[model samples]
Target: MAAIIAADHVSKWYGQVIGLNDVTLTVPPGITGLLGPNGAGKSTFMKLVTGQLKASKGAVTVLGEPIWGNPSLYFRIGFCPEQDAFYDRMTGLEWVTALVRLNGATEAEAAAMANRALDYVDLADAAGKKIGAYSKGMRQRVKMAQALAHDPELLILDEPLGGMDPIARRKTIRLIKEWGRSGKSVLVSSHILHEIESMTSNILLVNQGRILAEGNIHQIRDLIDEHPHTVYVKADQTRALARAFLSEDDVLSMKFEDGAVIVQTARPDTFYARLTALAASGELGAIHEVTSPDDNLQAVFEYLVKS
Candidate 1:
């Protein structure tokens, strides 16, 4: 499949500070998560993709056309930025209608589109409510409504799930999945690992203004597993559990804390299999829980950067 967005040696800097540093990437169709920490140049990259800001060097193209200085391309792209900027006095319907009208939609057509969008986001009842009166979640949905009102081919959402409650978050995630399933492309950026995990396995990891890694999350996790992994096991007999793994060659070290056995192993797959067998054998006391503090996106990014 052709890439929906592409960058070649793209770099963006603001005066003395660097936002992106010689980054190159291609985002395919369907939903791709832009995973990175704050100040990781996610916003800068998204801005370049959306044509909100020009790259300091190199090229950025979306849907086979250069994004910068391309006014007509805006109609095909929907952007829900992280920052909140709304007309507090205007109703949701009015706010979305105004945005759609800017896309050359007729007044009546804009209103109809706005209504449908509001309904899709489950905000039809609040369409007549003033923006100032809506909750944080409602405001987020309203921004999404405006983005969808124009029926763009690609959606560039930056932290769209932020500030939303559990129900609203799930609903918005479903909507994003639905959009991708409909054959549209979505570049959704978020710092939360599980959020992106639930939406799509395809991800691009960014850190310190550079692309660290990009691929399926499972593939990335497998790469990360090459490094030492620390797993914590809480059980009634921590000492017994620790002793059981002491003979294993892959077990690097062990420690005890708060009635939990913390084991460091170079081969976590082997360690986990042994642990599961021991638990099933009923030799060790009841095992409460098992967790790996290092098994997360942030840790994975750190490992990638250091490697």
Candidate 2:
């Protein structure tokens, strides 16, 4: 499938400070998680696609047209910025309606569309409530409502779940996934790895203002696994688990640590499978807790830097 958004050797810089560097990528019709740290050029890439910034070099296109100086293209692209800024005096409904009207809709048409957007985010009841009075999660939903009011073809969300509570996060994730199933493209940016992982398996990993990796999380995870994974397994049979792991070919090393057996393995899934059967057979004893401190973004970052 042709990409809805395509960047060809794109680079952006603020004088000597680089924001992005030779990052090439393509986003087709589906949800894609933009994974990176605070200053990892994620926002730069999003801004480029949204036409908020002109690329310092190379080119970027959205829907077969260059995004630079293309204000008209916004009619089909909705953007929720990373920073939260709002008209506190205005009710959520009024704010959303006003923004929709900027799309050239009449007051009546804007209001109707705004109401539907509010409903989609489950903020209908609070539509008339003051923006300043809404909870953090509600405010986040309000931002989403404005983005949905005109029903754009693509959604460029920067930290869409930033202030959401657990329940609201789940609801919003479900909505994002529903958009993908409905065949609407969504480019979601977030520092929360698990949240993005929950929404989509496809991801674009950026670091030092460059594209470090982009593919299925599992594929990247497999490559990162070459760095060796340390899994802390807490169970009554710590010695037994250690002994059982000693015979495994993939096991690199094993040691006891703070009431837990720390096992280093190159093949985690296989180790997990063996552990599962051992527990079921009443051999490994009761497993209480399992934790892999480096299994998240830190591991990915470490592997990227080392490589």
Candidate 2 per-residue lDDT, tens place, 101-125, comes to: 9999999999999999999999999
Question: What residue runs in model 2 are displaced by over 4 Å at the alpha carbon?
Answer: 219-299
Find the 10 residues in a row with the least total lDDT in model 1. 288-297
Model 1, residue 236: C-alpha shift (Å): 35
Model 1, clash count?
Answer: 0
Per-residue error for 230 in candidate 2, Å, reads 17
Candidate 1's C-alpha runs over 4 A off are: 219-300, 303-307
**Clashing residue pairs in candidate 1, if any?**
none
Score every model by TM-score.
0.75, 0.76
Candidate 2 root-mean-square deviation in Å: 8.7
Query: C-alpha displacement of 120 in model 2, angstroms?
Result: 0.5
